[model samples]
Target: MDPTIRNAKLQDIEFVLSGIREIFKIENDIFVYSEKKKLARNAIRDKHIRVAMRGDKPIGFSWFKIGDLTPFGLDYGKWSRKYCWISFVYVLKNYRNKGIGSLLYEDIMRICKRKKVKQIMLDVFTVNKKSARFHERIGFKPLLSIFTMRAR
Candidate 1:
């Protein structure tokens, strides 16, 4: 059976946190679970999350936010007033490559169209080639590159 996508609720906090933890593990990044929990709470309250459910269990989710481009010092009002930033899209390890992620992305695209968003952006770690390729396959092109270094 195919999973259905729906907006996440406060009750889904634990599942969202678990997915974020899994992402951190894959990227070898450090994080404070409490902080992530707070962010997830806010995202849910703002209706910025879409969860893919199989029966009663959440198998994947996508989190995103829409904002005006002018705030970033890009004063191209004629070009685009709003943009979307996809923060995360995660599927359970056991259920990957099964098109759940694509379904989650399609849900976001529908929302963006309804909201008149001009562009969508997302970040993928350079080490995560699989994710980058997936995004590419979904028609996301690289606009810029961000690099980070640890200051010793």
Candidate 2:
């Protein structure tokens, strides 16, 4: 089905948040509602939240922000006045492999371009191979791996 892509409405807050929590649970066996809720609420309220739906059901979503210029986005240093960062892009498991994620990403890209954003950045978990591949395919290059050292 051709997915419907548009800006998320205030009414979509709960539904979008629920969808993100559900998707995150697939990877995180022990999901924390508090953390996810905070992140979801922030993303949903941001003007950049893009929602993709199959009828009334939200199948995918992406959150983005325009700020300082970075390398992983369009026009490196050209629009130093503005930059964009994609915080979250989630698609339901059942909808994986479809073009929905790409669609949402493209929408974010369009927004960035319109805003004259010079670059964009996002961090994908090292373990999420699918997400890594998707970002790479979408023209994002890995710069560094974020790590934490625990003294045990």
TM-score: which candidate is best?
1
How far out, in Å, is residue 104 in model 1? 0.3
What TM-score goes with each of the models?
0.88, 0.78
Model 2's alpha-carbon lDDT is: 0.75
Stretches > 4 Å off in candidate 2: 22-39, 69-81
RMSD of 2: 4.4
Q: What would the TM-score be for candidate 1 when compared with the true structure?
A: 0.88
What overall lDDT, based on C-alpha atoms, would model 1 receive against the true structure? 0.88
Candidate 1 per-residue lDDT, tens place, 13-64, comes to 9999999998888788996899999999999999999899999999999999
In candidate 1, which residue ranges exceed 4 Å CA deviation? 69-80, 149-152
True-structure RMSD, every candidate: 2.8, 4.4
Looking at model 2, report the run of 10 residues with the lowest lDDT sum: 71-80
Residue 60 accuracy (lDDT) in model 1: 94
lDDT of 2 at 145: 73
